[model samples]
Structures are given as structure tokens and as C-alpha cells.
Target: MGRYNFKLPDVGEGSAEAELVGWQVEPGDTIVEDQPVVEVMTDKASVEIPSPAAGTVVSVVGAPGEMLAVGSVVLVLEVDGPGNAGDEAAPSVVQPQPETPPAAEPPAGTERTGAPAGEGNYVFKLPDVGEGSAEAELVGWQVEPGDTIVEDQPVVEVMTDKASVEIPSPATGTVVWVKGAPGEMLAVGSDILILQVAGPGNMTAAPVSSEGPSEAPSPAAVAPARATVVPAETPERRAASPATKPGFATRTPGEKPVASPAVRRRAWEHGVQLQFVPGSGPGGRITQDDLDAYVESGGALGTGAPTGRQPKTGTEDVKVIGLRRTIAKRMQDAKRRIPHFSYVEEVDVTDLEALRVTLNAQYAKDRGKLTLLPFLAKAMVRTLPDYPQINARFHDDDGFVRRYDGVHLGIATQTPTGLVVPVVHHAEALTLWECGAEVARLAAAAREGKASRDELSGSTITITSLGALGGLATTPVINYPEVAIVGVNKMIERPVVRGGQIVVRKIMNLSSSFDHRVVDGWDAAEFVQRIRALLETPATLFVED
Candidate 1:
């Protein structure tokens, strides 16, 4: 048996390190080639690194939440035959072997070179992915300037208000320049990036330089064509200042906290403001120990019980990234593009609750139990036909509203990552049981981060519910392009005047919002009332038109 040191591969473009999320396999566990071994997260996404060769895990390195650099050993494996570790280890004794004469040089035009022929500067443009949109918002960059990239490697992600997509590189090369920053809009066919390639490229006709090994000049023999001037370090600059040094307890005012990504993540999770926590590392750099000390000192203001009544001046600025950023941008765009008007209405679900309980008690064994959402979904599916204007996508740019006959319900779900709305396609055709099942499936997929693009988008109208944690009321932002969004608040038993005397009744409020441009106030109210009528009467949900 031979030992293999499995290192973390470069999971993200130009990412030097990744946060170790978890290990799928433990020590002594046998794994096959292509089996997922560890899960890590870069700034962009969480990726599961797979084993390149089958082996039994001998040992594992790094804990969850630790930042591991690319190519660093994360696992030691025992495999059949000689492994990579043996080849990499230093030799104890030198063994002499007979040397052979070098091979003859290749003929002209057949000289073997490392780079591809005709390599040159290639300008990659933003492709039109058939979204019919003229421009797309730059979400984030996967590769940075000066980073070497391969063909088909995702360089950037862009959103066209309809969907988000990763733009891959057309040719492999070194990135010389990038077009735009995140949040900026770039037109289709516009240059996205410029790459420096080996051969004659798509742009410019500079002749390729070809010099033989024997003809190559030494560094001292020839003055360089372009000389790179490096700045000289002065004695004071070379010496570490307290501010720039690592092992220090405090930092200068307004200086950002210096900590490793892992330590920063830990601090964020603990809600310990790094600004208030004095670091013990060089240059006032915060470490894991420092974060632990701050938390133990009861100085963490983000979580746990309050330390004191003293004014908490510590504030941490968190740069939103990935899905959170996408959500923020969509929400901001929704509010800005669509004039929203909110409508709140209360519903009596006493009979509905009784029916739900009875159904769950009866069907919980054979069939899956149902939630209030399925019932609400059934109500909306029935009600939308009466007010087609509410179930539509408004192309504000085109000055038109496209209402659909089929209902694609978007169930707004909150996951460990962030908010995502999984669509329940053809909800109008699905039975109550099927609707409940689909919602459950989609919700699970979303929460697990396994939801596909089809499952995540294409909602004619959306229904967002907080379930038990839902408060009394909430004005939900409309899922843009779709004219309306229905927000379900908490369900509670409260005293209400019924008939003559006050009686305890189960009540829930529907806080819904609509695009005022397409849906009139009366129409929105009427549409919600229709749903209320269907839900309040639960029996009507089964009766078809």
C-alpha cells in the first residue's frame, strides 16, 4: 500500500484559499474515484471536491470553518501501488545512470512549442443568450486581471432581469483587462474582457516571435526591450510598524480589522465586532484566539445576552456577496421599476384548520401530511382565474402585460444560504395532495441548494410565507416582472365578535403587494378577497368550475 496526500484543488477562479465547509469522508473510510470527499466554499459558491483516485482515507486535515489554501494537503489516503507522495519525497542516495545524446532538432514549421499556434489578444464579448434583452447586469467576476484562464472557464456571472448566467471564456489566455464591476450593466456584444494569448489572436496582427534556444540572449548580454522598475524599500518602510505589524493588540483609528478569512467568518458568526476586539497578533491582526477571548469576555455584542447598558459603538460592515447580493439587486430593481401598493386582509381559518388536522390525522400514514401553504396555494390557484390581471408578468419596458392561463406558483423559501423562490409549475393542474408534495419537494431542494434553474424561476405569481415565525403583517416586495406577490402572515387564535358574542377563532392575514401600473387598487383588493372567500370556505377549493 502507498500513501497519497490529497490536496485542495483550485475550486474558484483565482481564489487562493477556500473555507472548509465540511468533510464528507472521514479517516478509515474507503472512497472511490470521483466520490465527493470534502466541501469547501469560495467567495462565490460552495463546491464539493471529488477524489481523483480511489483510496482509503488515512487521515484528514483542517476543521470546518478553517480557510485552506489551494494545493494544500487536506487528506492523506492509502491506495494501491506507488503513490504521489513517494515520488515527491527526497531521495536518500544518488544513483548514477548512463546519459544519452540529445535528440536532433525538429525541422522548420515543426518546432515543438508550449503555446498554441496563432495565439494573440482575444477580446471576449458579452454573448446574447437569447434573453431578448439588450444588456445584462454584471453580478460578479470569477477571474481577475492577470489571472491565467482556460477555455470554457466561467469568467463572470451576469443577470438579464430574467435569469442569471455564467459567461465562460471563449479562448484560454491570460486576462489583461476586465470591462465592468459588479452591479454595472453591460451591453450585449460589448467587450467583456481582453486576453493575452500565445498565437496570433482575433485582434491585432503582430508577428509571433520565434527564437531558437541557442540564439536566446542571456540577461546581462542584452538590454531588455521593456524594463520593469521596482520601488526601493527604505529602512523605516522595511521595518514593521505597529499598524502594519502582525503581533499587536490594537490598531490605529479607522483602520479596517486585520484577520484571516476564517477568523473573520468566525467573528461574524459569533456577532463579535472585530473593531471592538483587540487583536494579539502582529500588526493588530485578529486571530482565532482573539475572537475566542472576546466572546469569553462577554464583549460580543452580536449575539448572546447583553454585556451592559454601555453604548455599543462597534459596527461591522459586511460586504454582501453571491445570492444575498443577487436578492438585494432584484429587490431594489423590483421596487424601483414597479410602483408597489400593499393590501392587507384577514381570514378566518377555523374550519380550514379543523379540516387540515383531520386530513393530517387520516392521511399522515399512507400519504404525506399537508401544510397551510398548500391550502393557500389551492385558494390562489382557484382565485387567479377570476382576476387574471393579478397573475401576470409586466414587461414595463415594452409597455405590455402578459397574463398566463397556467399558474406557476413561486414559494419563497429561506435557506442557510439566503432567500430563494422555488416554482411549482402548473399548480392549477395539481391536486391538493400533489400541490403540498410539490411545495415540500421544491422547498427541500431550495434549502439543500439542489434546486435547478427551472425549479427556481418562471413564476407567474409568487406566494411568500414565513410559516410559524410569520409576524402579524409584512409588505413583501413584488418578485419583479411578475405583477403580484402574496405574503402569508402568522396564524393565531384570537377573540373576535361573531354573531352576538366574542368567540376564539383561528385567524391569519394575507399581506399582498401588486404592481400598481398593471393592477388597480380595486382589482388587487378584489383578487385577494376572492382568495379569502375560497380559503374561508375551504370546501370551494375542491369544487371545480
Candidate 2:
């Protein structure tokens, strides 16, 4: 059979290499044209690579976890004909090369003299839609290769460093080929689909060079009556136990044992595992507090034991992968690029808490419990008009701050993976109940990894809360590009003098960070104080003109 060499193709965003994460096919395995062959991880995301021609895999060029330069030979396959003997006759593979303009092809159906207009076949490449600078992982495919797709319909969901975006079909036609599978990374300029159009007199023509074997049968041809199907998640068993293996049971003969990664890491770092510790996590997993308690109880990591030996230092290597890496890059950019400052205040929210409790009892079934966030958001929106500077963003290039009239407040949420801030669009116009409902919806979506790019961006300001975790005060970081962020802490009981009588009262802390270049300290403090006043009085929050 003729050997077809599939070289790593250029994905956009200047990516020249990718890590081979997984392989779907092995040597000697039969593969269909356009079927996924491998999965790759790049700085941007994980992606799948599809077969270029129907063939039997002859050789795999690389091992998983190995970094392969783009345009390199990833795999070699024997197609419909005998293999080429000379190296010159075989497809030469190299690492991925920089993006170049693709060669033009003749319009489809033009081979026939009486072909119908608008019936030409075409191949569509995934476009660079946003400020995306690297390859994107193919998280999912709405349609398989060879499946007919309609214009404007979403065909694939690509996960970039920023967010997942759905790629839409470019035109209505029969899908002739697909070049990648779910979880494979595809470069920005890469060809994602090939389409064939039915022409006049019911004529059809091939899109590729005739020297190659005939194209594989389209999905429509083989399954004409089948309905469109959505893909489902594959099931796999995962480890469910927490017992330690034989070799890692103890530290040294004299060292006390600490269970779980969180406790061990902290104890090892702080040299506190020498004392007795208790576990509180799943399956009695040692938690951070256990290590803290041990340290407070006079524990030490043996007198001279050099603090865990610096992890055998050599090359400081790190892989920029997943959500944590994305957050790091964004935060770094924000700090380096934006001018920031801080403002703080404390609010007496006793009245607001009473109102919330009353409302929850009144609309228990219809609206659930009301949170401080919605009320705070409402107060911020109302105060924005009086201290407009706090609601503005500075444009460094133009030397002006653009003040926004509409309020879009981003709520910072913490998830198992990482922290995400999803926005509540047009918060100023929505009622307290509506704001509460929207906040709940967005927060839930962010926790579930279902927040879209739009939901995560375009915020005029942000609100961050540690909820019960935050004690009396905290200084929150501004979500860059947004000029201000409000930090809400837990409400606690403290002694206060009321009419010369000492009494305990519920009080909360309000800390706000702002872009000092845009908003002055005075204005920022005033804005937070206004919110604090509204919360303390409660009636002011529901005031109508």
C-alpha cells in the first residue's frame, strides 16, 4: 500500500511544538479517513489530530509525554497502494512550520460544463476568532467528519486558554472530511472540515488531487436515514480509596506520620510533622489545620534536618497547563499592566441581615434565601452616579478614563479547579430578586465549568467574598481591566457602645480595591461607605425616587 506521511500541521498562535498526551491508534491498526489518531497538549490547550487518509498505521513516530516540534512526522501509514521505496517519493515530515497562505483550488463542480451556481465544494479552516494566541484543544465535536452540517450551526467546541468557544459551520454542505478528534489541539489556521456540494445534473467531484485514492464514503451515504446524534461522555473507573501504599507509610524512623497531601506539604514546609496530628478530610485525611495544630503544640521536623532538602534542585521545570496556569498569566499581566490602589471600610449590616431573613421567610418557596451580594450590588449601582470615578476604567494609551453608565458586576467564585469570576450583566436594571437569581445561576455555572467566555468577561467592577472564611478584614486583588473590586467578609458579633451602654452588635468589614490612576482614594472610600450605610439602614437599599 502507498505510504501516507502525516506531518504536524501548523496551528495558529505561533505554536511550533506540542506534547503528545495520548494516542488513539497503534501501529498496524486500521483507521478511517479523518478519524482521530492522537491527542496533543500545547501551551494553549489539548487537541486531537485526525487521519488524513484511510489507511493502516505502519509506524508511530513518537511516544506519549514527548514534546514534538510542529511539522514533524507524527505517524506513517500505508494507504490503498504499495509503499514508496525511495525517501524522495514518501511524504517528508518536519515540525510544524509558521503559517503560510494556503494554495487556491478550483471552485467545486466546475469540472462539469453545466454545473449549478452556488454548488461548489470547499474546505473550511477554523478561524482565529478572538485574541487567542495559541492552539486550542478540541473539547467536543457537534458533528463527525463526513457528516453533513448546516451553515451557522455549531460544529465544534474549542477550549483555549481563556474560554471555550463554539466553532460554527461556514456553509451548508455535505461534510467530506474532518481532521481532528475531541481533546486534540488544532492550530488557528488549520483546516478543520472539507465539504462537498451537490451540483447540476446531480454530479459530484472530488476536492483533493486524483493521484490519491478516492475519498472515503460520507456519513450521509452510509447512514442516509439516521438522525443527528450528539456525543456522550465515556465512562471509566477511578481510584476510590485513600489508604497509603506499603513503601510510603512513614517519613523516617523518628518522624511522625501525617496523612494527605495538603497536611504533608504544609507540615514538611513548616517543619511541624514531629508532633501528633489528627486528620479531618475524607477517609481521615490530614488537613491543613491538623498541621497548624501540631506546630502550635510545639512540633518540629527534628533539630537539624534541613527543611526537606530543597527537592533535589536542578533545572526548575514547570509545565504551563490547565486552569491554574491560565490564572497565573492573567494575574501577572493585570498587575504589570494596570495601576492599582486600595480603600477600606466597615459596614453595620444588622438591619440588612434582618431584612434578608424576613424576605427569605416571606418568599421561601418562590425565591429562596436572599444574599448580601445582591443588596451590595444594588447599593454600588446607586452610588455609582454620585462617585462616577469609582465606576470608571483608565485607558493608558489615550490618557483618559472611560466611565460606564451600565453596571456589570463580576462575582468571584472558588471551585475545586481554581477561582473564576463570572459576570452579572446589566445589574443596575435588575431587581434585588433578579440579581440574586442571576448571581446564583452564574456562580453555579462557573463551579460546573460551564461558564462561557462572555459570562467570564466584560465586567465593569467585581465583588469578592470569602464568605464565612474571611474573618474581620481582607484586601482583595482587583480583577484587572476592571477598575474596582469590593471584598466582603463574614459578619461577627463585637462589643460596641450604644447610648453610653456597652452591648454586642453584628458588624462586617468592607474592603475595596481600586485603580488609583482612575479613581482617587477619597472617591473609593466614599463609594464603599455609601454601600455600608445602605446595608446598615436596610430601608435605604429599597428607597424609590
Candidate 3:
């Protein structure tokens, strides 16, 4: 046997370094030549580095999220013969270190057999997101049972009330058990997965009778039970109910009540103390029905207390997941964090409309039909030079504001999934036709769920419109981190006095919101007025500054 050092090849045009996104193989894993071994992300694209020779992976260099330069030794492997590493190179003999001790190989028959049932298994619990949420819905799992996982790799994506985040694995091991299905809510501190790690793991429990944890308790033991109400008018009648009476048990005077986190949260919300509630679940555990029965028996009723009402028909519970959940979180964060100040201005676009119609008539075949949005985009690009602060991002946590010289415009588009803001990058460099084309392309890509991650992010400012569905005026929410958002309202022909005479003209309203922490009221108003002036004149939009 011999040792070989594998280096990262140049993945891009003259690229010197790449971010180590993740590893595909760990130590002790066997690989073949030309197999992808590691994934690195460059400025242009994400590339997977392949193994140069078939070997057993001995070790990997650098951790995820760190920069690894090209031509650096990324992996060391053990091969069959005299390898590339010369005799003068490091020895094939193992070196001793104090931090991590080497493990003894298992017996011949038990080489690949996982820790007998539940022994040597680490239960990965759901962690508190610190948003005061007691539970999060399992959106999806990246790995399956029996798949190997590494520390700090994303194993699951969970959606909470505040945001959707990926939960990273805490230990390197093989997945032996997974808890909840997608769309099921899992409580904080509840086991989400069980991993079979080397040596004694973080958890020690009773032996299972089956191959895996199939014989273990159901994951629902940690999930919230569904609430079912039975009609009972009096306390005596409630005590007679089967679910509340049979197998029911209560805690001792000093013993704390046993309940899932979901039930505890419900009790706290209704101002019902668990010390007084009876447990009707297995092993003296309190279920959701127990709480309801307690509340019906004249328990403490706070503002969250349910009022008596007639029973209604069946209702469906739709779990919020995926894109809808993301939109909800971002909208909530924008409203909660930004102190918004809105300014509305009316612009007469009769001249601009006439110019647009003439341009379409003259160049309809050569150029695509131009909409008002492209014109509005051009006008904003022209007007942003005088109001640099409006084209900026506010990093509230970092306590800094980044005002950009380039205009990367976010066009709010409505898709079948949800509302998405597809960006038109470097809008200041594009012509009016080019801006329209780019917006159309991005919107199509976003609606089809085919937009790349780079195409959806990095916007200095945003423009939102509802097209003909737009009302008189709207208070647009500034996209979080961006200082300003421009809202385009419905355009209509109305009778108005023009040059002392009542004349009909095409009019539109520009309703915009600015982050009060970064932009003042006077500057916001002046900014809108400048955009209005450029749009209303229609000629100055083409003039060089």
C-alpha cells in the first residue's frame, strides 16, 4: 500500500481559489478514479473536483466554508502500489495524535453492521431557533436512512414561524433513524434523527428488537396530538369522558407534569397551569385533549382562551412549507424591522404614452413592444444618480449602510408558487429594450422555478407593480436590507385642468417606501419628485447627464 496526495485542479478561467462548499467522500470511504470527491464554488459556477486515482480516502484538508486555493493538496489517499508520493514523502505508517484517538476495527462478521440496534446511537435533536418558537415544521430531508453524513453538513430543512433554515449535522455518522415526515411539526429538543457513530454516542437507550430503530417508539410521541372535542356540559360529564377519564393520572403535589413541548405551549397560551391539569396519555403524559378538557372545566382563561361556540364543519390544516412559507417570513421581517415612510406623487404620462405608441408603430418588428415598466426602469436609473442614498442596502446587524454606484434592479413578479423578485443586474448599463428583455427573461425563469440562485439575489433597490390590477396607490414594503422600493400604481385617463382648461390626460401614481433609519422624509419626497419629472417629461430620460 502507498499514499497519494490529490490536488484541486483549476476549475475556472485563471481562478486561483474556490470556496469549499462540501465534501463528497470522508476518511475510510473507497473511491474510483474520475469520481467526484469534493464540491467547490467559484465566482462563475459550482464545480465538483474528481479523484485522480482510485483509492481509499485517508483524509481531507480544510473545512466547509473555507477558501481552498487551486493546486493545493485537498485529499490524501491509500492506493494499491507505490503511489505518487515518493519515498522521501510522508510515511504510510499512522501517526499518533492526542485530540482524536483511532478506532479499532470491528470483528470480521460485524465490520459493516451498525451499532446493535440503539446502542452507540446519537439522537440529533431539534435546536431552539431563539425566535421563541416551540416547534418547526419539517420541510424536507437531504439525506435518507442508511446514508452517511458528515459534521456541519445540512441534513434537514426546517420551517419555523420566523424563517426556514437548514439544520446541520453535529456528528459524522451513518443515519439509522429519521423522526417526522415532511409537513409534520417537530418540537424543539425532540429527536429528529439517530446516527450510528463510532464508540459510545451521545445517547444510551434500551435495545431495539429489529434491525434498525423500527421497533422504537413512534416519532409522534414527540409531535403534537390532534385536538378532538367531545360535547360535555358539566365538569362531572367531562370526568366521565373516555379519553379524559380512562387511564387518566395526575402528578403528585411536587412532581412536574409530563407533556410535549407543543402541549406546554398551548397551556401557556391559554393561561392554564400544567400542575393542575391531569395527564390522560401513556405513562402519565398529558395530551392535547387533556388540555382542552381542563380548559372546558373552567381553567384559567386569558386572552388566548377559546370562547364557547357551536361546533363547525370539517376544516383542513394546510402546512405552510416551501415558497409560501418563505414569502410569509420575508414579509413579516420587512414589516417588523423597517420603519417605513411612504410618499405618493402623480405623474402625467400622456406625452410618454404618445411617444411609446409612436415608437411601437415605427419599430414594432425590429424591437419588441415596450411596456411602461421598461420606461419606468429607465427613469429610475436616470434619477438615481442625484439620490445615491435611495439606491443602497442597510445591514442593520452590522450597523452599516452600503450605497452602490451600480443599479441592480429587483422586479417584483407574481408567479404560480408565490411572489418573487427577479433581478435585472447592472440595469444602468442596459438600454431600454435590453432592460425590458432582461426583465421578461428573468420573470419567465422565476415563474418556471428555473432561476439560478445568483439571478434571484443582490438588488440595491426594487420596483413592484401589479399591472392593471394596481389600485389608486399602494404602500409598498421595502425589501429587507434594501433602503427603498418603488411602487407603480394603475394608469388611468381622468379629466383634469391642463393649462387652465379641463382636459383628459393619462395619469399614474408613484407610491414608494423608504427606510426611515437611512433616508429622511425630505429626501424621499424629493427622490419621488425627480422620478416623476423624468417620466412626465419623457424627453429627459434619453438625455445624457
Best prediction by lDDT: 3
lDDT at residue 150 of model 2 (Cα atoms): 66
Let me know the TM-score candidate 2 reaches against the reference structure.
Answer: 0.48
| Per-residue C-alpha lDDT of model 3 across residues 359-423, encoded as one tens digit per residue | 88987789778889999999989889888889999999999999999999999988755788889
Global lDDT of each candidate: 0.70, 0.63, 0.71
Q: Which rank order by TM-score, best down to worst? A: 1, 3, 2
Model 2 off-target regions past 4 Å? 1-320
TM-score of each: 0.51, 0.48, 0.51
Model 2 lDDT per residue over 1-545, tens place: 57877777764446666655557888789999999998665433346679888888877765443455687677888888765433644434322221223533333322322234666545566676443355876654555545666665556656544344455665667665565544567887665665665542122453534443232333233234222222222100000012112222323222223242223323433423222455554434455565676556544322343666467543322224456676787789778877777666777777788889999999968976679899999998888888766676666777877788888898999964568888999999999999999999999877654565567778888999999998777777788777889999898988888899998888889887888777777777778777878888889877886
By lDDT: ranked, best first: 3, 1, 2
Cα deviation at 508, candidate 2, in Å, is 0.5
Clashes of each: 16, 19, 0
Flag the better candidate by lDDT, 1 or 2: 1
TM-score of predicted structure 1? 0.51
Global local distance difference test of model 3: 0.71
Which ranges in model 1 have alpha carbons more than 4 Å from their true place?
A: 1-311
Task: Count backbone overlaps in model 3.
Answer: 0
Give lDDT tens digits, candidate 1, residues 419-480: 88889999999988999999999898787655765677799999999989889999999998
